[model samples]
Target chain A: MESFSRIPSHIGIIPDGNRRWAQEKGYQKKDGYQHGITPGFQLYEILLQYGIKEATFYGFTKDNNKRAKDQREAFTNACVDAVELLSGRDANLLVIGNTNYPAFPEALKQYANHRVHFGRGLININFLVNYDWEWDLKSLMENKCLASHEISRIDLIIRWGGRHRLSGFLPAQSVYADLYIIDDYWPDFKTSHFLDALRWYQDCDVTLGG
Target chain B: MESFSRIPSHIGIIPDGNRRWAQEKGYQKKDGYQHGITPGFQLYEILLQYGIKEATFYGFTKDNNKRAKDQREAFTNACVDAVELLSGRDANLLVIGNTNYPAFPEALKQYANHRVHFGRGLININFLVNYDWEWDLKSLMENKCLASHEISRIDLIIRWGGRHRLSGFLPAQSVYADLYIIDDYWPDFKTSHFLDALRWYQDCDVTLGG
Candidate 1:
């Protein structure tokens, strides 16, 4: 593996198009979220290998809960499973979101707001569950504290499934993020897709308007 | 000349690469900003022809003032010129920025915060001068109101000069913007580039995370 001279300290992941991927594969929309779990693990291992300091994954959004009942339950459960999967790993995992909402997973509420160490805690992992951009920013207005205040600024944001839009990602943190998009769906995660993004990041100005 | 059945009512423009474009043309970096003015008018006309309701153009940023003295002056003057250029046109013009700072142009102080109607006010134009994402969102924390409260949600964000990053262009409003990148520099503005982006946006699943 070619090592990067300047690896991004924090990477934001938008694993999109799972349902579309499942539909194309002739599976129920609910079944797509299950397949996305392995990709999360695959990306985690890759991040660990690269010694990336932190990562934030889009688990499910508040708007995402607007999905059909079965689809919503599937993705919500998938997020819980993903967090549990990281429990035994060497990660400082924290799930940030609106836990007050019923869409927030009951099993994952333990990981919300505060970071819990799993093993050596080599990398910081932030999983956004039932997250909303308005809800995230509203904290600053209503409470004078951000729910996502613990997470640092994102250096690069990689989105799967060919969407160019941010879809309400952490706006404050992602202000200067170098965005990379992959046409492949989240279920069809490939190491090369991530590697390609890293290579592209090397050439970015990364000057934050300086 | 073809009209779109579904035109994005509000479009955000990130006209990047003025310095690079000037350097490539064997001109001083300061000269780049002057050349970018024509494209602004061209884009405005196109938007008016298509009956697009609102548009936002990224002027200089607070960070941009960190550049060389001449370069800062050049871009600052360019933003002032761009706003003045729109004064006689049929648009509602507003400049959002930190006017308290010395970096903001004196000529643009009147346009800040409040929207001034031009001839007939057929379209709304927002020019972000000395804008910062942190500063824009910080208003919510300290003042309980956004500095950019007048702007509506951005439907599509078009960036000229090949960069895929947002570089802090109205973060709150751009949560669901369909980002389109054109490798061509701002000085090299072609109507076809805007047309191509519209064509791409036509296929976008603009369903805000639903």
Candidate 2:
């Protein structure tokens, strides 16, 4: 068992490769996403076990909503089921994304809120449905509301299947953050993989002025 | 001439060891920082030569306010002068800290704004002073603001005279950024180091979904 002395206070995950995982398993692409529910839930449990206080999963990007109607519906169903399962556990749920995805299902939104309202422990599950970093920064700068100093602090950043760069998630804000990249595809992501990531976080140093 | 293809979009400097740099030159710490200004400006010119757009200097953390009154005044004077010099150039200046330091002279704030306004170009030069990342993220989340995500965006992140970890600066956001760490102390940082970092950025591949 890895020591939990250095468990990260927060972790962010970019879940990737549901379609590929499904195709590889000889299941429909949607089936691969459906399969992701269990592992994603288990991953949350493992994070909780290691005393991680916060985790953010990129449930769906704005681009995902651009898929065909049938495909979007299937993906939404999978997401709804996944949220339901994870919400049953004792963790906060935060859904972060742009809120403008036309294809975003009401059921998923309702389910996410339901999880927050009923979860055993307060979990921050946010979805960024229609978020854009540049616009936000521009607005902040224009309004003179942008704080000159430190605004947000991040402990751990997890990217499940994306490339190294941020792809412009939160550019101005992430001036300083610890990052963890996982090789497992989002659909294939398992509880053990999350545990492994947490284990790495456990050893990360947060010393000032290093 | 180094290729501008890999120039870093964003650069961060810790501006460490003014006292040490001063001692090395057989001068007072105050003299070291005053002398440091020339090289810092020269480095900025090099960044412009390489087509770099954004740069941040880590000057005067919150702890600076806690230092001896004389020392803090001297540091603030140097900062004001530095700001004046950069503001006269072709750069949009961003002062990265609250103007709440008692030790800081009030005249410096207006000088900073005046210099930035004078530069009047697309160039962005920011100073990260007394900034905290965690609180900023929370405010964004609470206010329902979204961060932008664009294709092939935000090429590189540089940490000068700082460690690899996030250490509470933009914790949630920094996870996805590509980082470059330098061994040179901030006071000793030069144009070559800035160019080297830019070179690395030029060579970085920004393709997504790998």
Candidate 3:
């Protein structure tokens, strides 16, 4: 078994390139969402196995919602399905997003901005849906200071599908995070890939800029 | 002449591994700071030549203050010298960092939190010295909202040194920024490396998660 001397306390992920994955497979862009949904749980299982304290997934962003209507619908459905699948798991699930968006998935309606099954298990899982950095910053302005640490500071950020940008996953939370990028699309995500990221995180000297 | 279809509007950089660079050369860690100082100007020359709009350097962060006194002194001197060197230039220069830090460079006292020498080159140059993410966030809380756009949203972030983390380089500005990392240390940085980053960026499809 692969081992890391240290495991990041909280990891954030941006799984990208579903449309490209679908197009390359000669499938419709919507079909890619179906394939993309499975990796979320796979990643969670691995994080849980390692006893990682927390994991955050970029479920969907405002920028993501602006995609073609069909693409948006597919993504919303996939997230709902992923939530349904995770509901049976032994973990705390929280959805943090701008639920004000019109197409916010109905399946996650009850869990919006709240933690569900809080007493469940070894890991805390966060999914951001219809999230926007601008929206989050705006709220910070109005609220003065947030009392609750809703978003844990990210230790590592992994982006799948070869893209190098955060696309506004969770900037405030990612302030001091290490970033890892993989060319593999979300649908093709493997346990080995997750292991490799953990290993990479282990190799880093977390000087925090010192 | 090298060309890019779209050039980034603002670029943020984290120059790392100066000590490691010195160690590799069989010299004291402090000696590396001397070699690292010149590259900042070299990078500016290249960016100015290319007419790139803006560049931000992570000259020092608050966490960096925790290093050995000698090391911290070396970094502060290097930054003060760099700021003094740029003071005579045609570009606008700004320093975004915690000036409250007792050891904050005396040479940079004039340019603190304000843009300096708003003239010559088309490029806007920002150097972050003694910066802390938490400090900036706190100021945002007190002042209501930042006016005059203290930091332009970063388009691309490049870190020299093999590490892949931002280590607290301007998280809010980096919300949707593309990240590029190089294995070379700051002292070893070359103009060719900057050009290569532009080339790599040109090949990216900046869908911004849509």
Candidate 4:
């Protein structure tokens, strides 16, 4: 088993580039969503093997609903499937998003703001669907903290598909996250990509400001 | 004259690596602050040349005050000096931070929350001194948005010293900002560094999730 002196307790995953990966494969944009599902389980197993405490996966964003109806349905269905797949796993699962919004998956709404254990609850898994940074912060208008306050601060964020923008991840929690970008698309995830990010994270100067 | 097809209207600058640069040059860690000042002005002039509308500079965080007395004083002095230096420039200067706190520089108190037009106010310059992400969000308790709400959403954030973390910069404003990291120390700032980041941003898929 691979080991390291330091491991991020909470890792935020932004699985990007599904459309590009689909285009490159001569497939329609909507077809790429299904291909991205297997990698979710693969990463979960890796995190479990590595003993990572908590992980958050970026499902479709609220803005992503702007896409064509077929593409939106494809991604929404993929998110529901991904969450159901994790429902049978050994983790504490919570789906965070605007449930009132029509775009949010109804199947995942039962898990919203409520953590449910599948088996042993060895790790925490947060799935964000129909999420927006502004919507997350809007809760602060009435509450003292973020709507997604249940999720702890993120130690590291791993983004795939070569984009350097946060694209509206958990803003408050990501204040001190060390971002690791993988050029490969989400569907093209390799075990090596995650291991490389872990290895690179070993050298981060994590002085949360001081 | 260097130009680009797409220019970020508002750019966030995190000038890191001062202490490392100081140590490398056989100078005390505190000595690095003064050297980082000139680069700020040089960048301001470049922004003017490029017609960029707004920029925010990370001076020092509240957590930075936890450093040794000498280092704290050094960075505090640097922030004050940098703000004073900009006082003569043609920009609308607003210093965002907890002015009520004793750790904040008294000299910058006049600039807090109030936009002071230096000359013609051609550009907006926001200098963060003794700032905190939580503190910025705390304003949402009473107000509808961030304490730094006057500053619009950031388009690009350029960080020096090679760190990939936001380190508690304006969280809400940085939600979708593209991050660009420069490996060189802040004191070793080069005009080419800024230009290179702009060149790289030209091809970014500016699709805000669409």
Candidate 5:
């Protein structure tokens, strides 16, 4: 693995193109959940080994619920499985999203929302499920309870898909995030791609609009 | 100019690296403003010619106010001059920024914020000066009068001078903006570069996080 002189303290991951990958692989979208779930656990281990403190995964957005029922169910089940696997391990798990959204009732309910599991590892893993950009800000606007208790400014945002746009992942928090886009589909993602993203972030000259 | 199958109705331009261009040219920072001012007017004309209706320019940010007094004055003067020049043309001019700031006391006094100058041209131009993302959102939180009355969602956000981060420009509005980055400095920016950005936006498969 290539060494990074400065690894981002907080990194955001947008896992996209899982269903598309399933189609490309000539499998039903329901069968694609297996590929998506395994790599995320592997990534969490990789990130922990790298000693990265904070990482947020854009697991599911409210808009994703608009997809076909079977597709939505498959993605949700995949996300829950990943979260359950991660929660059993060390580190804090924080989920930021509207749990009350009619589409998603209980997604890793025990570990979903703002419950942090005190664990052996030092890294903090946040799973953003059913997250909407406006709703996140709407909470702030009303001086109401924040969806998630703790949120940090993301330093590097890696999107695994061909898309270049943010896709509404913590819009305010990503104000100065250096985005690294990967052409590989989320399900077919390799660990090498993750390392390359870290290396790419190291090459960025982040002046923060000075 | 190359044709685009899909042109963004609303575009946001982040004009960056003007001072760097000046330094590279072995000129004073103050001299850079003169170069930055001209292309903006030219861009407005280009947008009008291209049949683009809405355009916003990051003329100055609240962070820019933190620079040396002379530097701030020079840039502020340049922005005011650009706004004045655009105002004279027949287009709706709306400036999105905090006017009470010490930096920009009187920038086209009567037509500074929210005053629409409905002109013969179909293009609508907005110049953001002394604008800050947090402050803009803070008003909505406090129930106080907003700094700017009108704001539009940006479809394509093009930043000059090779920076990828948004740098706190309309965070909520840019939730799904396809960002286009140019290595060319703002002063040296060309109409061709603008056209390329439009063309690039046309190619982006913006699914809006679905």
Candidate 6:
């Protein structure tokens, strides 16, 4: 894609609205999660085509641990499967955050190792499990670890269905990041939507350059 | 005191140029910090007269702890003394985190207790000691522990020499919050500047009246 010239080096996604999508389609919530995999795959492929090097998917937040065990297990399995499939791709995969619930660190660790063996970086498919934004921010700021200059240089950020608040993910970096918000459920996001976001990002880059 | 009608409910100060202020005045940095107390007192009186309820003072951040222990101890003692004096005036005081070098919680607990004993909720003073904006913002967004609302609902936010990039304070509340930045050094802030900021706050409040 010629538009690859403007694709972001790192793209973060807030995958939201799995329950709503499932209910809307008269499927069990687990089914909604299962269905979500297709769109995720499509988006990943499109990002790859556009030459995006890094993608962070907001999978299960710490809050997700509150769901029923069966649902949680299903979601976790989906995540592991997604990671396994993506491992075969050229891009790296990382699963971030401490997997505290379901005591699934071993499972996550095993998948992460597999991804690495497949040639991805140690943290390529990052999943923020049991993450606390407040503690992290405090540590960074106090330690003077904020990479302010680097972050302000970002080209684009794509938010899927989640609201537009910094959420402690690179606040300093966002000042210069072109932002795109899609109203559709994250699980329903398609390749076309991803491309549309990329187009908007390209337009922003051109405008900013001019 | 006619400006009291336009006073800001919240005011923030960045005490910069301590070493420079000291050097210019032909005094040691310690002397500069001591000199800062006089203007600080004047500012407090002005804020009180103007009916401002919240005043955030940027004291030592985590980075400050890296200074010689003797110097750090001196600064901490000075801060403690200042709080003691303010506590005598029946002020509601809070110590905000720069989070890297945590002040002894006991110190703050003692001061808070003293304030409760003094019987005054009319004045609230907070020291953003080693404060990290990222942690604060993240807690507000993910924890649900923070009372979440629209960002637009925030009456006013004052940043004294603070940068604009949200840094880590992301997912800005849905409501729009009024922002004010002052150029004056925190230690040198005067009653006139306080009054001016208050007037602006009043104007903003009126413009966005509930």
- List per-prediction Cα lDDT, in the order shown: 0.91, 0.57, 0.82, 0.91, 0.80, 0.53
lDDT, candidate 1, residue A71? Answer: 96
Give the per-residue lDDT digits (tens) of candidate 3, residues A1-210.
677899999998888878889999999998999998778878887887898898898888888877888988898988889888888888788888777768787668898877788447668888888887777766656776532248788899988999887887776788778889999998998998889899888887776566
Alpha-carbon deviation at B24 in model 4, angstroms = 0.7
Candidate 4 chain A worst ten-residue window by lDDT: A138-147
DockQ-based CAPRI category assigned to the predicted complex of candidate 3: medium
TM-score of 2: 0.65
Off by over 4 Å in 5: A144-149, B144-149
What clash pairs does model 1 have? none
User: Between 4 and 6, whose DockQ is larger?
Assistant: 4
* Model 1: residues with Cα > 4 Å off, grouped in runs: none
lDDT of each residue in A1-210, candidate 4, tens digit only: 778889999999999999899999999999999999999999999999999999999998888988999999999999999888888889999888988889988888889877889888989999888988888898988777688999999999999999998888999899999999999999999999999999999999779978
TM-score for candidate 1, please give it: 0.99
For model 6, give the interface RMSD. Answer: 12.2
Which stretches of model 4 miss by more than 4 angstroms?
A: none
Model 2, B1-210: lDDT tens digits are: 766754556655555557666777787766666766776787777767766676666666554555666666677778878876776678777564445545445755653322254445766776654544433443455554322111112345555544444343433334345656665656777667766776666665654322
TM-score for candidate 3, residues paired by index: 0.95
lDDT of 5 by residue, B1-210 (tens): 567899898898998888889999999877788789888878888888788878888877887777778788888888888877776787888877877767664845566666576657577888788888777766766754345447677899999988778888888778888989999999997988998888788888867767
Q: Please, what are the lDDT tens digits per residue for candidate 6 over residues B67-101?
A: 66655666676676677677667667666553333
Root-mean-square deviation per candidate: 0.9, 6.8, 1.9, 0.9, 2.0, 11.8
Which has the higher TM-score value, candidate number 1 or candidate number 3?
1
lDDT of 5 by residue, A1-210 (tens): 567888999999988888779889999976776788878878888998898999999988887877888988887887778776876789888877886766554756666666587568578888888788777777765664335537888999999877878888887778889988898998887899889888888888866655
Q: Score the docking of each candidate (DockQ).
A: 0.84, 0.17, 0.73, 0.84, 0.66, 0.04
lDDT of 2: 0.57
Least well predicted 10-residue stretch by lDDT in candidate 1 chain A: A201-210
Superior by DockQ: candidate 1 or candidate 2: 1
Model 4 chain B: ten consecutive residues of lowest lDDT: B201-210
